[model samples]
Structures are given as structure tokens and as C-alpha cells.
Target: MGMKVGIIGCGSITKFRHAPEYRANPHVDEIVFFDRNLQRAKELAQQFGGRSVETIEELFNDPTIVAVSDCSSNEAHHINTAQALLHGKHVLCEKPLAISVKHAEEILKAQAASGKKLMVDHNQRFTKAHQKAKEIIDKKELGEVLTFKSSFGHQGPESWGVDKSNATWFFKKERSHSGVAGDLGIHKIDLIHFLLDDEIEDVHAFYAALDKVDENGKPIEVCDNVVCALKTKKGRLGTASFSWTYYGSEDNSTTIYCQKGILKIYHHPEHQLIVETKDGAVIKYELEPIQTNENQTSSGVIDAFIDCIIHDKEPSVTGQQALASLKVIEKILGENGI
Candidate 1:
């Protein structure tokens, strides 16, 4: 028998990634969908051949659900995850874990107490380019990774949301914690830690809300651009930048500098890698076209999480690892007065 799964939020992410992925996975015997918006949940349940629950409590109380996926907003992450774990269900939460380190820690505490697996969806870590980069670094091909730089940014959430009104929540600091940094920067931070296998010892960051405001004159508290310099425990120095004001379609890239060579991963125009070795050998690996369902990236992440649950195996990106990334985010917000 396959593990039964429930999704806590039936919003854009559920429609795009989780539902389709769960439906596609044979290891998922059943999927229970929940959302504050009953119509949305019912629609998703109908489309994905899953059952719909009206409330999160109903989903949690169902004895058949072996795991729950929290795809709610930044503020709801901890609460939803805690409730799932308390109900004796494994949890897979979307990135940043929570709006603050304190909330994230609480979720971790719940995980420990419940003895349930908790995973964070840091999908960039699972990408082929990043995986190949880790392999090369582990092989010592890059010598010592002395410095790292990464960035993840896109036009704003307005383009991705189901309703334009949905984008307004992203501009409120109370709802989002911070703007581009939390939304996009957290991914880059997690990637930096994963690839270098190092922790950020300290961070000095600068953030600005240069653009992305409403029709009204009120200033949007969330930042649109952020840049930070970091010191790693392994003595490696690094920098990261994120922005929602980018005029281009999307820009997600990373560069690593080591004693012997340099590695670059580009996500836009082409998902390709470039490497230049000390011996004057240059190599390029062009990524194959990615086939995504309605929400391809999120679907990939969900499949991996389901596999971990059924196999009783550790997730590719653990909650604790995601917490490490959240710490960096907290440091940045503290420094910038956000």
C-alpha cells in the first residue's frame, strides 16, 4: 500500500505542483485536499481525483493521511506544519519554513516531539545543474571553494498569482516578513549552504524597496531588492543578491570561485553550465529541456518528498537545513531594519 497524503493549501502551488505530482505518483495511494477557499479545494480535488476537506482540522483528523504538505503562505507555514506533525503525519513545507527563526524553531521542536519526518521544499538543490556542481566540488575538481555568489529573482508575484489581489499580500511585511529576500533570496542561501556544505557564520545585508508599490501612495514595506555578503564557517566568503524589479523574464544564476576552476549555472535563456579549469580546459554542459506539468518545479519537489515518506528515508532537503537558510534570512532582515 502507498502512503496517503494531504495538502493543506489548494492555492496556486497546489494547482500547479502538488496535486499533479501526487496524482502522477503511484506511491501516493490517496490525496486529501484542503483550503480556506472551499471552492478552490473542491475544484482541485475534482481535477486531481482526490477528496476535498473543508478545513485543515478535518484533514489532520483523518486517520488515513500519513503525510501532509504545507503550501500555505509564509506566515502559515509553522502553524500548518506543527498541526500536521502533532497529528502524527510527516510534513513537507515550502521554503523559508516560517516568517521568523522563532517560528521555524517551534516547528522543529514539534517535529522532534512527534518523531515525524519534516522536510523543506528547497527545490533548487535538486536541480540537475546544482547536483552536478556538488558532484564536481565533492570530487575536489574545484580545489577549495573559497568564494561563492548566487542570485534568484523574477518580475514580481503578480504574474504568477491566480488573482491580482493575491499579489497584494506579498507587499505587506506582516504577511511576507520581507519581500524579494525572503521570497527569492532564501533559495539562493539554501543552495549556497548545500553546494559548499558550509554554514553562514555572519551576514551583512542591504535592502531597498525601489519598486513594486500599489496604486495608493503607501510605501510597500517589503523590499524589492536585496544584497548581502556572508562569511562561512569554513572560511569561505560569499555574496548573494535578489530582486523583484528585474526587467527581464527571470534571472537565477550562481558562480563559484575556487583555486583550480570556476563554475557557473544559468537558469534563463538556457539552463547551462560553464567551467574553466586551471589547465586551460573549458567545458560546457547544456541542460536538457525541462518538462513541467502545470507546476513543474513544485511537482518535482513533491515527488521527492513522497518518495522520502514511503521509503522512510531522509529528505534531500531536511527542515534543519532549511532552518540554516532561514537564519541567514533573519540576519539580513535584522541588519536592514526590515
Candidate 2:
């Protein structure tokens, strides 16, 4: 029998990635959708051939649901995920596991106690360019990755939200924690860790609210841009930046410098990779076209989680691994007094 699954949020991410992917997977027997806005959940359920759940509690109380996906706002990640685990359901939570390190730890503690799988949807690691780059780096073709530079920035949340209200929760520190750093930076953080297979030791960071204002013409509490220099435990050095006020097109790029050569992955260029060796040997790779739905790309993350649950294997990105990235975000925020 296929595994029964439920989704805890009906946000853009759910509409774009999770629900469609789950509907396509034959291994998923049934899907139950839930959202604070019951109408949204019902709409998505009808479109996806799933059932609409009125409340989180109702979803968890169902014995058929073997797993739950937490796609809620950042503040609700821990609570929703912990509750799912306590109900003996595996969880696949969206990125940045929790807003704060302490809250993330609390969720981790709950996972340990519950003995259920908790995966984080760090989907960037599953991209073709990233997987290829990781292979090259692993073979030492890049020859001891000495330094790396990565970034993820976009036009901002209002471009994607359905509500588009006067008060975007992303602009509020209380609801979203840090803005661009938490939204975009965390992706790069997870990417760096995945590519290098190392943990960050320490970070020195700077952030600014360069161009955002609230309804009353007051500067928003969250930072619009952030930059950080990091040192990894294995002695690798790296620098990264994230911004939400880019104004232009979305920019997600990474460059790795190693003892022998350099590699570049540019997402807008459509997974193109450019490599330059120390001897001036250059090679370029044109990756296969990625399939996206509703402006969001649904890669192997959802499938991987399903495989993990079916085969009793570990997920691609575990909650503990996500907590590590969240710790770096917290460090950056604490350093900046956010």
C-alpha cells in the first residue's frame, strides 16, 4: 500500500512544489491538505484530487497519514513539525527549520524523542548544476576547494504572496525573523554545506535595510540585504550575500575556487556551468532543462522524502542538518543585533 501523506500549509510553496509533486507520485496513496485559510486548502485539495483538512489537529489524528509536510510560515515550522512527529508521523519541513536556534533545537529534541524522520526541503542541493559541481569537487578536480562565493537574491516576497497585504509578514522581524538572510541566505548556507561537505566554524556578517519602508513610512525592522564571510571547520574560506531588494531579475549563482581550477554555476543562465583550470583550460556544460510549475521548480526533494519513508532510509537533508544552517542564520542575526 502507498504511504498516506498530509500537507500542513496551503501557501505558494505548497501550491507550486509539494502538492503537484505528491499528486504525481504513485507511492503517495492519499493527500490531505490543511491551511489556516480553509478555502485555500479546499481549493488546492480539489485541484490535486486530495481531501481538505480543516485543522492541523484533525490531520494528525488520522491514522492513515504516515507523514506531514510543514510548509507554514517560518514562525510556525517548529510547532507544526513537532506536533506531527509527536503524532508518529514523519515530517518534511521547509527551509530554515525554525526562526531561532533555540526553537530549532526544541524541534530537534522532539524529533529525537519521537524517533520519527524530519527532513528539510533544501532543494537547491538536488539541482543538476549543484550535483555536477559536487561530483567534480569530490573527485578533487577542483583540487581542495580553497574558497567559495555564493549568493541567492530576488525581487522580494510581495512578488510571490497571494494576500499582498499592507503588512507583509516577511517585513516584520517578529513573524519572519530576519528578512533576506532568512529567506534567501539560508539556501546558500545549505548549498555551501552540501557542496563542501563541511560545517561552518564561525561567521562575521553585516546586514542593512537599504530600501524598505512600512505603511507609515517607517523603516522596516528586517534587513533587505546581508553579507557574510565564513570559515569552515576544515579550513575552507567562503563569502556569501543575499538580498531581497534586487529590483532586477532573480540572481542565484555560485563560484568555487580550488587549488587547481574554478567552477561557476549560474541558475538564471539555466544551470550553465563554466570551468577554468589553473592552466587556462576552459570547459562549459549546458545542463538539461529543468521542469518548473507555477514559477517554482519541483525537483527530487519530494520524491526523495517519499523514498526515505518507503525504504526506511534517511532523507537527503535531515532536520539536524537544517538546524546547522539555522544556527548560522541565528549567529548572523545575533551579531547584527536583530
Candidate 3:
């Protein structure tokens, strides 16, 4: 029998990612959608061949729902995910886990008490390029990695949010808390953690609202750009930048300096992973194009979530793993006075 899935939000994340992915999952036979705006819920339900729930309570109370995808606003991640977990459903929550570490811990406690699985949608880890990179690093094919730099930047959420405007909740401090750090930076932080198999031990960051403006043509309240230097527990050094003001094409790239070679990701158009060794021997692996809002592609997150549930195994990106990345985000926020 296929599992029944509940989607807690009907925003851009849900529309572009969760809903369609869940519909495509062979193990998912039913999907239920809930949104604060009833019409939004109805519309997604109609489009995805699912049912529209009038209230969050209605969605949670349904005993048939075996899992939930919490794609709500950043501010609601904790509440919505905890409620679903407590209601006996495995949850796949969108990243940053929670706006605060305290809230994230609370969700973890809820999962522990409920004996349910909790996963974070750190979709970058599921990318083919990133997976291949992990393989190379694990096999010591690049030798011992020493230093690295990564970045995730684009035009801004205004181009993709459900409302598609500066008025979106992403610009509201109360709703988003930390801007690019939480939205884009955290993904790379998680990716680094996944790739290096090490945790960031320290962070120093600089952030500013570079160029994004509000509905009134004034600077938004949140940081639109961030650059940081980080050190891992293993003494590996790295730099990262996140931005909502990369007016040109998106640049999601990272380069790792290792003892034997340099591993570059997303640095080539045809080859997603490339290595140039000390002897000048170069190797390239052709992988799928990076998935962006404009260049949509399957994330492999929903499928992984379902496979974990079906196999009764822990999610690849667990809540605790996400918390480690969130701690780094908190450190950066503290340094910036955000």
C-alpha cells in the first residue's frame, strides 16, 4: 500500500518542489495540502491531484497520513513540524530547520518523544555532482582536502516566491530572521558538512543589505549578501558567500584544495566535477546541470525521504545534522548583530 503524505504549505517551495515530487513518488498514493490561504491550498490540490485541507489541524488529525513535508515559512517550521511529528507522522522539513536553535531543539525533542523520523530538505546533498564529490573525497581520490570556498547566489527570492514581489515574507525580519544566511548560506554550510564530514568549529562573517529594496523602493530589513570565513574542527579552512543580489546568472560553485589535486564543482559548463592533479592530469565528470529556479530539475529529496520511511531507516539529512549547520548560522548572526 502506498503511503499518504500531507503538505503543510502551498507556497513556492511546495508548488515547485514538494507537491510535484510527492505526486511522482511511487510510494505516495495520496497527498493533502494545507495553506493559510484557503484558495492557495485548493489551487495546489487541484493541480496536483490531491485534497485541500481547510486547517492545519485537519491535516494532522488525518490518521492515514504517514508523513508530512513542512514547506511553510521559516517562522512556522518549528511549530508545524513539531505538531506533525507529535501527531505521529515522519516529517521532511525545508532547511534552516528553525529560525532559532532553541526552536530546532524543541522539534528534535518532539521527534524523540514521538518516535518518528525528521529530515531536513538540504537538497544540495542529493545533487549528482555533490554525490560524486563526496565519493571522491571519501576514497581519497583528491587526497586530503585542505581548503575550500563555496557560494550560492541569485537575483533574490522576489523572483520566485508565491507572490513574486519584495513584499514576500523573506524580507520581513520577524518572519525570516536571517536573510541570505538562512536561505542560501545554510545550504552550503550543510553541503560542506556533508562533503568534508567535518563540522564548522568557528565562523566570522560580514553581511549587508546590498541592493534589494522593498515595495517602497527602500532597503529591505534583512541582509541581502553575506561573506564568511570558517574553520572546521579538523582545522580545515574555508570561505562562503551568500547573496540575493547576484543580478546576473546564479553561481552555485565550490572548489576544494587537496593534497594531490584541486576539485572544482559547478566550475565548468559540461563537466560538473573536475579535478586537476599535481602532475597536470585533468579529469572531468559530466553530470546533470545544477537545478535552479529558472533551470528546474528533480532534487531527489522527496524520493529519499520516502525511501527512508519505507525502509524504516533514519533520514540521510537528520534533524541533528541540520542543527549543526544551524549553530553555524547562529554564530554568524551573533557576529553580525542580526
Candidate 4:
């Protein structure tokens, strides 16, 4: 049976991921949109042959929306997601479920009361290389993972944001909230958590605004770069860095060093996943190219969220898991006293 869905934002994420993926999914029959900017919602509705709703209540009251994708800005996630869940709609929220763990928990409370699904768009977990790496680790093919390094960076949000202007909310600490730490760092934090099947127990981080400038030619208000060292609950150690200053090729890669072998992911274009054993044997597994800011690809997140609703299963990236990752990011951003 086809289901109707609502999307809470018409920004880049909605434009690049949610809207198109919903339109493509055979299970989805309708796409209703609501944005602070009514024009953006109307435009997307027109482009996708959907409908633009002026208010969130209008979308929620429709009663036909089985699920909603909360693609709003970072600061708005908690409110929008909680309201949607309370309205009995399964919600797939964007990364950093909330600016704080407290807010995230509130959303979770709403989810519990509503008994609706809550998924976060931690799409790295759905990547082929990452999934393969997890499988290898689970089989103990790499033995105990000892140390690791993972990074996610690009030419900054101005280059990727819908407006393609420096004034994008990502540079504003108020709206962006945690800057690159929440925008990019949380994704890696969540990825590490998934790959390790653990939570970050310790953190030491440093972040700053290095290169990005605002429309007034002043340095962006929020940190554009971040570097951190983290330790997982199970004692796995790693270093992570997130940046909006990688003007070169976007780098989204992780190298895991295990007792028996090393797993290198997205380090090579041809061999996206490579394993190097302690005994000098090396193996390479080729997969699809890593999705970058410039190269748009199926995140698999939207599909998974819809499937979960249809199958009456829990979300693939649950709100609690996202809260765990967000807590690590809060520590990195020096929130909650670290």
C-alpha cells in the first residue's frame, strides 16, 4: 500500500536526499512539504509534483501522513521532531538529533509516548564500505581493532548549501549550534560508534574557525575546523577531524588498525576497502565511489526509514543512537563541561 509522507524542511538535505528519495520510493504515494520559507516548499512541491503546506499543523492535521522527514535546521530538530512524533507520525530526523542530550531525550520521550519510529540520518552506516568493514570486524577477520583515524571534510557549506552563499546557517553558531563538530564531526562519531559497536567514553578536542568567511567578508562565527581524540567504552582509541576548509577533493575516509590486520576505507578510489595483514598479505575490495558533496548518491537512509515503517520495525538509526553520537559531539564542542 502506498503511504503519504511529510517533509519539514526544503533545504539542501530535503532537496538532495529526502524529497527525491521519497519521490522515487514506490511505497511513498505523496510528499507534503512545509518550510519556514513557504516559497521553497512551494517550489519543491511544484518540482516533485507534491503539495506545499503553509504550516506544520496543516501537514500534521492531514492525518494521512504516515511518516515525516525532519530536515529542518540543527536548532529546530528537537521541536519539529517531537511535535511530529506526538502527532503519531514516524520521524526521520537529520543528523545531531538535538543540540543537547537533554533535548534529544525529550524527543525520545515523545517517541515513546507516541510509539512511532524515530530515525536519524546518520547515512554513513548505510555505506557499502562501512557495512563491509563492520562485517569483517564482526567475523574477527581483523582481530581486535586497536587504533583508528577517521575524517570528514569539504569546501565548506557555502559551496554546498542551497544558497551557495557564506551566510548559510552552518556558519552561525546560533543556528548551526555546534558548527563543524555537529555538522560533520557527529557523522564520523556515529560512524565510529556503529563500526565499533561502542560509545565514546573519553574525549579531547580542539576546534576553530580557520578559513570560511561570511557575506560581510568577516570570518564565519562558528568553528570551521575541528580535531579530536576519542576513546570508546570498550577501550578502542581513535582520532577524528572535521573541516569545512578542505578546498581540495572532499576526504571522507577511515583507517582501522587491528591486531591482525588494518582496514582502510575510502582511502583509494579503485579499492575503496583494503585490508593489510600483519603477515604482509594485502587484500582489496572494490565498491562504489564514496558519496561526496559534489557527487550526489542514494544515501539509503530514506529507503530504510520507509521500510521500517512499512514493516513495523524499529528505525535503523534510532534516536537513542543518535543521542549517543550527539553527546560525543557535545563533549568535542566543550558543552556539558566535557
- The prediction achieving the highest lDDT against the true structure is 3
What does candidate 4's lDDT look like per residue over 1-338, in tens digits?
Answer: 79999999899889988999999999999999999999999999999989999999998887899999999998898899999999989999998899788889999999999999999999999999999999999898878889999999988888889999998998887788888888899999999999988899899988888888888999887888999899988999999999999989989999999999899999998898999999999999997887887888998999999999888998899988999998888788775322
Worst 10-residue lDDT window, candidate 2: 288-297
lDDT of 4 at 323: 91
Computed on alpha carbons, the lDDT of every model, listed in order, comes to 0.82, 0.86, 0.93, 0.91
Residue 56, model 4: Cα distance from true site in angstroms: 1.2
Q: Select the stronger candidate by lDDT from 2 and 4.
A: 4
User: Candidate 3 vs candidate 4: which has greater lDDT?
Assistant: 3
| Per-residue accuracy of model 3 over 90-146 as CA lDDT, tens digit each | 999998899989999999999999999999999999999999999999999868999
The clash numbers for all candidates, in the given order, read 0, 0, 0, 0
**In model 2, which regions exceed 4 Å deviation?**
267-271, 289-294, 335-338
lDDT of 1: 0.82
> Of 1 and 4, which scores higher on lDDT?
4
C-alpha lDDT of candidate 3 relative to the true structure? 0.93
Off by over 4 Å in 4: 336-338
lDDT leaderboard ranking = 3, 4, 2, 1
Tell me each candidate's RMSD, in Å, in order.
2.1, 1.8, 0.9, 1.2
> What is the alpha-carbon lDDT of model 2 when measured against the actual structure?
0.86
Model 1 has a clash total of 0
